[model samples]
Target: MIGKARGQEGREGAAGVLPAHGMTHYPAAFYHMTHLFYQSGPPLYAGNICTGRSGTAIISLMGETQGRVLLVTSGKELLMEMTPSMSGRGMELVCVPTLKYAADRLAAGDCPTLVVDFGWLPPSERGALLELHKQFPKTQLFTLESVASMAPAVPSPLRRLSWPLPMGFADQVRVIAKPVIILADQVLFSTGAVQNAFQQAGVQAESLEFGAELPDFIRRQSEARAASARTQKPKKGWSLLGGDEEPEQEAAAAIGNLVVAQFTGSAAQAGALDAAVRAVAPEAVCYLVSGVDTQRYAMQSLKEGQPVALPREQAGRIAGIMAESAEGGETRLKQRERERILLLDNFKPALTALSQALIGHGYEVTSSMDGAEALRLTTKGSFHLAVVGTAITMAELSGAELAQKMRERDPDMRIIFMVDQYPLKAALQGVSQVVELGLDDAILKPVEASRLIFSVEKALERRFLLLENARLLKETQEQKNQLELVNGFQKKFFATVAHDVKSPLTAILGYAEVLTGKLKAMPSEGRYAANIQTSAKTLNVLISDLVDLAAMESGKLRVEIGTLNLLAVMNDVYERVKIAATNRKLNMTLEVPPVLPPLAGDDARVGQVVQNLCTNAIQYTKEGGKITIKAELKPDRVEVSVIDTGIGISKEDLPRVWERFFQTKEAMGMRKAGFGLGLKIAREIVQRHGGEMGIESELGVGSRFFFHIPLNGPPPTEGAAGAAPAAAPKPAPPSGLPPAPRPPQQPQPPPQNPHLPPQPPQRK
Candidate 1:
């Protein structure tokens, strides 16, 4: 057994083999030593040793290599062995699998040399080691080998390194290190093969034992490489990764070119952070990142960028630093819609007063006495408006020049010049130039705070109006799209209703008609059946009319015109209305010229117009009232009128009489339930036939309703002859029974039935 080394509990292992100039190679048994060990005596103090339990001793050994290290290994075994003991020390070790990886690291200024275990490299990776030698002949390559002769230059016995250390040891390496010497306890035969390959590839190999002299050489080499790298230009930016605990204050301070505050909160909070920063520190640049769901309102409120999540304390410190910079430096935050304003003047009192006034008026205000400083700040920041004192005259830059510079940075930035008595002319001239560049206004000095505030308010108001207009325009377009969607839905729903409802309606009508015929012998039951059949028929007609109105509104209603006898159409309507007139005990007459000319119209629709008007007269006119229906041929048109002594329309109700489903107060009061579509359909039919229809009425008196159509059939061409003319004034009605009493007035809209297709409500 060998004697124990100093401060160690275990004895040194026996030296197994050595060359004339190589260090002693210890036996493999010594690798598991329980205590620190070294050479038995001072024989060049160069040999393999094991420090038991104390990895720090190994750290001392690793310190002997260059500061920046590119560690090349066939496997992680060697790098893992060195990491734990080497961490928290000054050495920077970068591990790689091949020499090409080492070259890449070197090219990126990661390290200058490859501390490679050539013996551990498999055959496939050996080619890159040899190729790298050709490309970078000066790169130092190390090999762990037992035989000294394998590497001719400074060949030394090497001990294989396979010690396992604590975790996170590799993380402590702060920067890259190069020209490293990897310690190992046992060398392989492949080490000799690697050295032979390198020599064949025209690359010299050097080997040296780790001892006192190597540390100085490595330090000097690292310094030289660092100096050279400093002289060379950098290719890109660099960032350092800090540990997971509290962020290193020194590291954060070093990267102060940008400081981001990421607010993780509601979108409202995030969106307001910009204005908040402006209000709190007008020079602070703020960006917000919200935690709100992206699927709802889009995450566009925060305009700058995404927010960063960091420890609260660390974020707070960063915020403090940014606020401090905003206060102490010439930099300011970018301006926004809330009207951030920058005020500059050499006059301290005036500047202070103006700033306070602006602040009182709810403006974010930043002020500086130096014009050049203002210019410098403009480059780093933004302002909605800049108020410059023309009286200011700085040696470096004048107020006008500062204004010009700010405008150059932001063309839309508003500038307001303040002039004293003497410089008013010059200020005005400068104002004109900047006006072309976007100056807003100028105010004379000795101006009232109220006036200045008004000017500021006006400027901000105008800008806000523009922004509001743009926002409203977007909203308007959205509403338009919504309306179009509603219209499409209505069209589809009406079509479906028309198709689905008509079948059931036809069955009801058919059944009621059969019941009416079967119950005719029983007078009371027959009356009920007749009522049901009448109601069903009425419903069928209403449905048909609704479909027609929908088609007419959508521009799909077809109109077929032909010559038709005016008297015949009127006679058909009178025949339909005569029973109602007799039931109501009213006098009704149909006046038609014997030789009346044929009118140009759809005959059924023309008859429908006449029938609806006469029915309305019979329904409204009470007992003993008179209704007169007349058709007369004019020069170019035929005019028909239905005159009734009935409860007439009020002035307010007359205008909307033609609207679909619009019923007057008197009409609804008569206890008459109707769709209110008759008059509307009548007018639509007449108008489609290129004719005109209208009603003349007075409340508590009588009424006259009329329609006129072309007598020569459909117009042959544009501006064809015999176009329908306005109707002639009707003669007074013959003396008859009293007019129907009008109901008390109460304005109300037309009753609506959801089953019917939707129409715009008529104004009462």
Candidate 2:
């Protein structure tokens, strides 16, 4: 039954017989007997090969006949079974699971030429294959689907009379040859979907199911094969694939205090290195000497203080050498030495005198009689300090205004304010103005030389102190930044994970909601759906709380300040939470005076504060408990309180109740579900709105939490803790309970009124 199918013979066979195995029980006879090879010798090919694709196996069998077989399939067990069978038939077999692995081997310029692609792969693997194909265009792509629809034309030399194929081979196994009709035995299944996919991918597939079609398919796969060998220029020499023999040379100028020296054919390089050290810094000067004489010369110079020397033995100790040098001690100071000083005054003589005084102190002074000229000079140069007169006769800017401009230019700049005379009462005004302008000091005019010198020296000293402090502060800030980076990463990770988890939970909740309505007639299913919705909501709440906490801690929370109607805010909260309160059989009430004034805060955030407090009350309270929300217009502020008869806080626990994640014993006892962040977030919001939030409670009684915001309403300004326009902060009830009873000072001796019998127990 085994047969060889050549050009004419394959055509007749394609039209002839069908096997009785339903094309499933493929005999091994066709694998050996089918002679369908091209005459171009060993050709390049690549594609996915797996059990599901019949053409891939056929292509693999063809490759085995002429050369080695490289199987690309993830099914290792399947390959293991096929390996021994293929080996017994005297063929070589190699298997790679992923397209990437196979492509990599091919790109190394040394791998098998044939690749058989079978079925759909992941996009990434397919992309790797496509990229490799671009690199080696001679490499052929053979698909099981593309080959099954054609009757392959087996060349004369490639055709055999009779060869026994290994077990489990079938010529009837179907393949999807794109847009071609071979005989029923060789026809492909599911050609439409595969062809459409190939079209979308811009792949031009050649059919190989017919004998007449073999030449064209081979032509496409071998388009560049003949040209590739003729075009390749031979490599010139043996390349060092590891690396270059010589290392890369670093730029000589980039070498800091440390210096590198190389001795060229001589033992005496010390003289040359000494000259080099003089060109840079004397305090540094490390020598890397191969000869003992050069090292001795360097050590002798160091001993005589002519120059410093670094040891060749200590060549590895770069950090230690840097530490020993003065260069390390004054790195920051050297950076700050290019200091400029600005002097401004209408009196040119005084200005010149003061300028000379500072210049004598080694300061570079830029002088100007006109305030406008001084500002222009500052613009032209960077200044470390400024000396400004109290008054100047300039068209553009006044002296104080000029100082303000300088401060704006560099907030760290030291400024000294000078005046003509220090009037007794007026001196305070001048001093306040000087402080407000951020000037270092204000000296009266006709200033004595000693006084001016003293003041200037003090200012410079203060400036140096500030600079040193700033340097230290920068180091501290770097450490702080590292910690903040870690915290930021953690926060972002939590936020991202929470967000990702929330998406699926949202879908689940949505589905459950839909199911709840649909399953109303089935109580059991409806109950399950309700549970799902409730669980999803609880998870959503936890995620929301975590996100809000992160936002608050990272300073990302924002509130828009405006005049808010307290009554409306309270009423809105009541309406939102009344149902929950009623469900617990708790009495909830809202009290707002009709003539209350508007408070200053973000309306939405203020509403959140109220809602949180009310919700907390509802959660904590028992049946028949009462909750009251009250808002009133105080003399300078609007006060809002949420009072509840609940499991009251203990004395020790009262202070810590606002701390995040600090759940109380009562809450834990009730097994309430919460993140314990509401009060903390509420307090932060209130503080951000320029308000004070507090609490009062007595154990076993009740708790009242309240916040007060200014009615005149000056919310905190951006980047500053500007106080609200309210009166000075007055201490509210200092404790959560009424003030403890004071001990009688002297016991009052039964009221030094022993005579009046305590006034008959106080007349009514």
lDDT of each: 0.54, 0.53
User: lDDT tens digits, residues 1-764, model 2?
Assistant: 11243322212123112111212322222222133233465533221222211111322343334334444554433344444344334344444445654554455543333333333344235335545655765443322211211122210101000011111212311231211211111101111222222334444333233333323433432334435545545443343454333322322112111111222222123334333333333222222222122223333332332322232222222222222222343443334454567777777667656665555455556666667666665652377777777776466666666677767767777888778675765556556777787677888877665686677778878888988999999999999999999888978886787768878888998998999999999999999999998888878877877777776776766666765766667777888899999999999988776445445577788998999899888888889999999876665567789999998889999889888889888877764678788899898778776567998888778899998775555333545232222343432322223222433332111212111223333333
- Number of colliding residue pairs in model 2: 18
Candidate 2 CA-lDDT value: 0.53
Model 2 segments more than 4 A misplaced: 1-493, 517-524, 714-764
**Error at 494, model 2, angstroms:** 3.3
How many Å off is the CA of 46 in candidate 1? 99
- What TM-score does model 1 achieve against the real structure? 0.43
lDDT of 2 at 18: 19
